[model samples]
Target: MDFKLTEEQQMLQETAARLVRDAYGFEQREAFCQRETGFSAEFWQQLAELGLTSVPFAEQYGGFAGGGVETLLIMTELGRGLCLEPYLPSVIHAGGLIEQLGSEAQKEALLPRVAAGELQLAVALEEAQSHYQLHDVLTRAEAVEGGWRLNGRKSVVIAGHSAGLILVSARTDGQQHDESGISLFLIDPKSDGVRSRSFPTMDGRKACELYLEDAFVSGAALLGEVGQALPALRYQQGRAVAAQCAEAVGSMEAACTFTLDYLKTRQQFGQVIGKFQALQHRMVDMRIELDQATSMAMLAACVADQPDSVERSRALAAAKFIIVRAARFIADQGIQLHGGIGLTWEYMLSHHAKHLLMVARQFGDDDHHLQAFSALLDVA
Candidate 1:
């Protein structure tokens, strides 16, 4: 199959790259992380003004109707900059769910504002015990007077502290771990009975632990149909895994670049470290891992928006597994090559390494995806 980017894709990639390069300098990123929101509000507005926020939605909602490739391009640039914005959680993951599962009225009410960046969103599907299992929902949503009362806790909600709305998953019926009874709800984070404890993640992004004690949402807040959100959740998460792989590739690229630069300039006993045969071999291994990661990222992007099927799921699992392993290798090797300077807070390489490490933990870890891929294998 052809692997060339279309002219429009190329333009989108360049626009995203230039925007990130100009706006996300190392010191500037540090300042952004210091803010209460843990990201640059001005840069978020820039994304809205430049229409980058609308890249994935339908045109009727003031978006480009772009798909996986477009998302990959934007996320790669974001990753390279070590940006702390909640683009993956807010725009890609939550917004895509609304587009896929929301009713016409829900869409008409929410999509435009989200696309315009007037509102931010987050997903709250993970429980403390769920690990990466989307179907292991224990949060309960019981039918009430005019809506539902939610009761349970959501853990590690990325950007949940600042989101205007949170798309939450709860067990509306059936037993825990059963796939048939899960449901989705759109909840106002500031509503009564909702509490959040916010903190900074290792990668400098903000996240929160959400507690819902009799948190009531109106009937209109339900997304898709009751007791049937698992399929869509799995599919959208597959897309997210694809986007994340691309982001990892970008971080790996930055890490590799920093290591190579350090080897060339840092003097050793008598010469630059780049001249050392042993170090040169290590650098070559880092590059090889990066190239393999890039290829897997591309493969993931290609299938990210495809119709759901066993093949699509298997491909995504394989891509994520490979990318995760590669990211860990590159992160370790990058820091090793940089020596003491790599661990310093002032260096961008250290930050990139942290981001790479965090990427391995999100969505599903390397071992998780490896098991998933193994389960999907054809054994005929």
Candidate 2:
């Protein structure tokens, strides 16, 4: 497979990199994170105006319809900048779901709004004790007079509180852990019977625990067919995993770059730390791992757009597993090499390190993806 990016892809990468450099300086990033919403509306608008919000959508929705590689290109830059915006949750995950499953009318109504940055969306899928199982849904959606009444709770709904619209996963038939009955619904977050408790995450992002008590939605809210949401969920989730791997690669790159710069400048025993053979070896090791992780990310992006579902899942799981391990190693080495300053609140490395650790657990962690990869292989 070809590894080189196309001309358009290169332009997208350069645009994203320039935008982050100009707008997401370390101090700017920190300020955004400290906000009550944990991100800046203005920054999100800037991204929208820059055509970022439209990257992965179809042209009819005013988007460029760029695929997984484009997503990787954009997210890597976002990760490097420590961007606090909800682009991942709002645009990639939720938008992908809409694109994949929404009816033509649903797409017309929502996709354009999303592209224009007028709407932000989050998916409420994970429930308490579900771990990383996408099919382990306890939320229930029952038919009502005019629509459906949803009841149950969701945990770690990323960007849930800030999203105007939420894509919720619920069981419409079978029991929890059964993929057959799982379904997806679009709900108004501000509607009655919807309660959200928000909190900051370790990585300076926000998430919410959502409680749905008889939350009512019109028939239009159901995405795809009833009891057939699993396939779309898995597809979007695979895209998310690919994006995460790319983001983690970018984070690892930043960590290594900044740590290397610090080593060059930081002196001990009348010599720069970088010149020390032992330290040099460690930095080389970090770089080696970064390269390997990057290769895996590229592979994941390539496979992410595959037509075959099982092939895509296995490839994504492998990439995620590699990325999780490499990101943790790079973050740990970055902090240790930088000494106590690495742990300080004001330092960029601290944020990147923390974000890297968080990325390991996002979507699915190292162990989770490892098992998934192995299971796929067994089935193959």
Candidate 3:
């Protein structure tokens, strides 16, 4: 397969990079870090104006009709800029889940709003102890007269405070973590008994711990059957992990460029620091890992749409593992090479480092992906 990006992808990449630099520069980013919402309304509106809200949906669904490739390009650019927006979780995770699993009416009602960026959605799936396990859900969902009553707590819910709709995971049967009990729900965040408490994240994104005290949901809230939500959850995991890899590739690339220029220009011991043998080797090491991560990210992006679950999972896990390992090295070495300046908030290297750290924590750590890879096949 030709790995080259099409003309449109390249153009979109450049456009997104420029928009992020222009709109979300250091001062603006710092402002977001201090704000209660941790997201810019103006920026969100600008994204809506740019039609970014519509990229992954089909044209008939009021979207730009772009698929995984287009979404990947946009996400890469967003990562390159170290953007603090919630596009991937809001659009890709929540929106894609809706597109993939929601019933016809469910899709029609919510997707158009998602496409237009009018309604923001967040996934309230994670529990306290589990690490990206979809089938091990503990949130309980009981059948009511007309629909269902959802009573469970969700941890690490992305964009929970700002979302209009929440794609929640709940247990309908069985006590322990098993396949039969877990299900997905699309409930209003504003519904009675629903509460979202904001937690300050390392990155400038508003994540929350959600409490659902007898939250009522209609039959339309059911995203898919209890047994089928795992597939959708897996798909969501793939998109998130792939997007993190893309972001890491972009951020690490920028970090490399920045470090090289710093070394080349800065003088130490009567010569340019970059001329030092140790630093040159460090740069080479960074390049090697960065390129490997880049290649794996592209592979995952390409195969993310494949119908075969094993092929997709294997590729996705590989991408996630490689990116986590390489990005950690690059981020650590970048900060170390920058000396004390990297430790300061005034320099953006530290900023990028923190964001990269957040990326490592996103779907799961390197260890989690390693185990995930092992679990992919029961065979030796």
Candidate 4:
């Protein structure tokens, strides 16, 4: 079977790329990122108008029903422009969680609104201990009179402060690291006793430290069964990482393109530096690595929505390894080739570099994926 994008997918890619390239141009991104909101509400609303927020959902919920492939396509373009939006966390992660694990009623209640960009959300699943391991949750969810009460702090909750809702992972019957009794819950961020404090990140993304003390949520808020959501959560995370790989691919490709263009223009000893045979080889190598990384990321994107656990983990980890390694190499070479200008804000190289760094480490970096790869392979 062919691996190329379908006509619709191509349209999605072109549409998203054009919109960001034109509307969220480099200057606009800088201005928007420096704002207090930390993202562009107008841009996000435009995405919603374009049905991007609804891409991965079904038509019944006003979504185009685009799958993980669509998300990857959109995210890659988003990375190229470094658009300051919370599409991944607010739309992809939160919406995916609701669709895959929420009850039918819950989906009907939350997803349609999310697809419309009416309710911004974040997945507050990462605690101090929830690093790389979904089932390693320490947050406890105890049954109370009207609902469940949460009492743990979630660290590094991306965009948590701006979210209207949060999907919290909690342990009901399981010990700190046990798989049994691990559960996912939906909580209103505006509810009593649920507080979030924002932290500015290196690359301008806003994360939060969430204090969920007596954070009450209804039983209807439980996503999937109490003990059965761990694997699903992990699966969603793999898809998220797959999207990140695509984003990294785009960022690295842009950096490579930027470096190549600079080399072609910057003169050394009265001749363009790109005229050198050695420099030509280096550019070609960077191009090769970027293309390969993008191809691997596309492969992972294609397989991310698969329900088979083994395949999902392997594909995501493999793509991550290829993409992360290539991204680092290409980015470093780009910076070196560009000389000091690469590090200066007057150029876009530094912006792309920071975004690439965050994406490289986001879900799981090289070391994290290496562990996952070993676990999937059953090797020591």
Q: Best candidate, lDDT-wise?
A: 1
Q: List the residue pairs that clash in candidate 4.
A: none
In terms of TM-score, how similar is model 3 to the real structure? Answer: 0.96
TM-score of each: 0.99, 0.98, 0.96, 0.96
89-170 in candidate 4: lDDT tens per residue? 8787878888888888888888899999888989887778667777788888999988798899888888887888888889
Candidate 3 lDDT over residue span 79-150, tens digit each: 777777788888888988888888888888889888787888888878987776777677889999989998
> Model 3 Cα displacement at 51 (Å)?
2.0
Find the 10 residues in a row with the least total lDDT in model 2. Answer: 302-311
Off by over 4 Å in 1: 378-380
**Residue 196, model 4, lDDT:** 83
Q: What stretches of model 3 exceed 4 Å from their correct place?
A: 377-380
Compose the digit string of candidate 1's lDDT tens values, residues 166-277: 9999999999999999999999999999999999899889899999999999999999999999999999998889888988888888899999999999997989999999
Candidate 4 weakest ten by summed lDDT:
126-135
User: Which model is ahead, 1 or 3, in terms of lDDT?
Assistant: 1
Q: What is candidate 1's CA lDDT for residue 374? A: 88
User: Model 2, 123-191: lDDT tens per residue?
Assistant: 898988899899998899999999999999999988998999999999999888787998899989899
C-alpha lDDT of all candidate models, in order: 0.92, 0.91, 0.82, 0.84
